[model samples]
Target chain A: MALDKQFIGREYGPYRYTLGEEKMREFTLAVGGAKPGAGTPGEPPAHVSPLLYDEQAAKAGPHGGLIAFPSFAVVFAIRPFSAAIADPALNINMQMLVHGEQDLEFLDVMRPGDVMTTTGRIADLYERARMGFVIVTSESRNQHGTLVVKGTWSAIIRG
Target chain B: MPRTYQPGDTFTHVRECDRYRPIYYAGASGDYNPIHIDPEAGSAAGLNGNILQGLCTLGWVVEAIAGFVEDPGRVRRVKARFSRPVRPEDTITFQGRVTAVQDGRLTAEVSATNQRGEDVLKGAVVEAFIG
Candidate 1:
């Protein structure tokens, strides 16, 4: 069975998310971030992986305070889309669904403690050959209402 | 201090995909697709064994660029096409070069390959604000 083409442009979620510092640290370490204190012995050295640990990066970098990797926006923005697909209306065959391609465009940096809201929509739905494709685009906005990130997530399902 | 980046600068970072990468990424990113964490399920589904998530490999690419740029927030955009599945224990290498600097944005053309020299991410591009 083919997915409902009407689900295209169907919108879901202006979900709220507050970024956390601990999660940022954990994600950094899990992705093979530099182990701590590899800094110079005699010096009060600069912390490695400032992207995850350095407040100075906030001062010198784009966003301040304890920061996160660029991809953390996925965590903030993904929930609603996942919920949308699971709503049974789409009839997504879980066993046959495959992630096709993903991309992100950053308009503003997301920082820890920023209360972000994400809204997602089924951007496109179409069929080619025997496969059904759904493209979901989500936009995350920071507390200041700045559009922090916009991402497009594509899933291909067997028809 | 934010170091100035110029075009033609080059660097590389190598990551060894630990056995638990997919699991951790799954927990953190909320993509609990069984192919990434359950070996039996994946093998039953003909993947041979559990495979790492594609976005996790994309994370590695961002890490490499962050290390080079020295500021995670400076990264403005990242895009990649998953050309191959990344398995546990695979050593993935990312080589990047500053291809252009126009206005305040710096562009780097990045390429990713596994230890066997198989292309895992191709035509990858990253843009960051250098100003």
Candidate 2:
């Protein structure tokens, strides 16, 4: 089914997510981040390692707590948008969908316990000879109403 | 802790894709697409097997940039094109180069290749704000 271009400006939600330390750690480990001073990847060393993986750095990190990794916002931002596109009104085919491109802009830090609200919009819709494209842009804001991050997720649905 | 980035300096980050990477990321990121979690589902989709999420691969590159700048928030902007599928057991390497520094922002061009030497992230760019 061809994606409806009329849905381009449709918005999804402002779902809330409270950041968690354990989630940050799990994401760090799953991505194969090389913990400082550990040959096989483990705990973070004080003087080195990315702030997202280091407890000490987290203490001194941006927002003064456990900071989520650059890509960690995905955990908080993708679900609502998924629901938006799956609306029977849109009639999107799920079986042949594949991610094609992604873009992210981090404007503020997201620390553990911070409440983030994520909202999404269908930014654009188009078609190639054998495929349909849907671009969704999401914005995440902290409890204080400060924009924390923005992401553009583009999926190419094979025809 | 702030780290200075200079133009022309290069760094490399290599990671082995855990056999269960797809499942792990699927749970963490809430992308439960069968193409990334079930091998049989992948075959039906014409892939070699359960393929890892492209964003998961991009995560490594973001981590590398965060490591370079010493803070994840310092990474201002990032974008990537999913050129190829990454299957289980792929050894992905991120090769980053400081292409330019302008107005307190450092830009890096990244090339991520798999065990087979294919450029999985053929066109990727990362911009970090240092000022």
Candidate 3:
């Protein structure tokens, strides 16, 4: 069944999330190729910038504080796309769906203790080569109302 | 002082999808999709085995550029298509070439390949502020 085009403009959220220091480090190291074990997120990899894990080093660096890895925005910004796909109205076949593409634009750095609010809308729905494509666009703002991150997410549902 | 960048500058980064990485990434990213953490589910879905989260692979693209610019905070944009699944025990090598440097910003094209030399991402591009 084809996805209903009427759902294109449907909005997902004003989801809010509070950044945490340890969580940021854990994410950075996990993606940076670190090996995690009991009671630790693992050591930061040699190539990972200290700005993402070392508080003191980051504080002394240009940003003057610990900054989350750029893609960390996906943690909160993905809420809407996740919500849209899982929405019962869409009735998407979960097993046949795969993430197709992603685009993220970071307007400013994100720091721990910063409160982020995200909202997104179904941008488009179409069929290509017998497969369904669902596109969602999201915007995340900080406590001060600065647009910190923007994302375009696509999902392909196999026919 | 910020480092200068020019078109044609190249950088590389490599990562291995260790057996437990998907599970660890699931814990950290809140993406516990069974296909990424459960081999049984993956097999049922026709993947043969578990695969890494596409976003985790995207994160590596960010790392490649962040390392080049010397600051994670300077990464301005990253975009890519998931062309293939990255499975456990697979090693991915990312190579990036600076494509443009303009208006205090730099743009680069990145290619991600697995050990078999299959492309895992397509149209991968990253941009960062260098000034």
Best by TM-score: 3
Native contacts matched by each model: 0.60, 0.73, 0.90
Scoring model 3 with DockQ, what do you get?
A: 0.91
Assess each model's interface with DockQ, reporting 2 decimals per model: 0.52, 0.54, 0.91
Off by over 4 Å in 2: A33-50, A60-63, B1-4
Give the range of the ten consecutive residues with the poorest summed lDDT in model 2 chain A.
A33-42
Error of 1 at A45 (Å): 15
Candidate 1, which segments miss by more than 4 Å at Cα? Answer: A33-48, A54-64, B1-8
Q: Give the best candidate by DockQ.
A: 3
TM-score per prediction, in order, is 0.87, 0.89, 0.98
Task: List per-prediction Cα lDDT, in the order shown.
Answer: 0.77, 0.80, 0.95
Per-residue alpha-carbon lDDT of model 3 for A1-159, expressed as tens digits?
A: 498999999999999999999999999999988988889999877888998898889989999999999998999999999999999999998887889999999999999999999999999999999999999999999999999999999999988
Residue-wise C-alpha lDDT for candidate 3, range B1-131, written one tens digit per residue:
65788899999999999999999899899999899999999998888989999999999999999999999898999999999999999999999999999999999999999999999999999999998
Best candidate according to lDDT = 3
lDDT of 2 by residue, A4-123 (tens): 788889888879899888777667666653332323335543423456656775777564666777788888877556866687887777778888898989887777788999999988
Candidate 2 docking quality: incorrect, acceptable, medium or high: medium
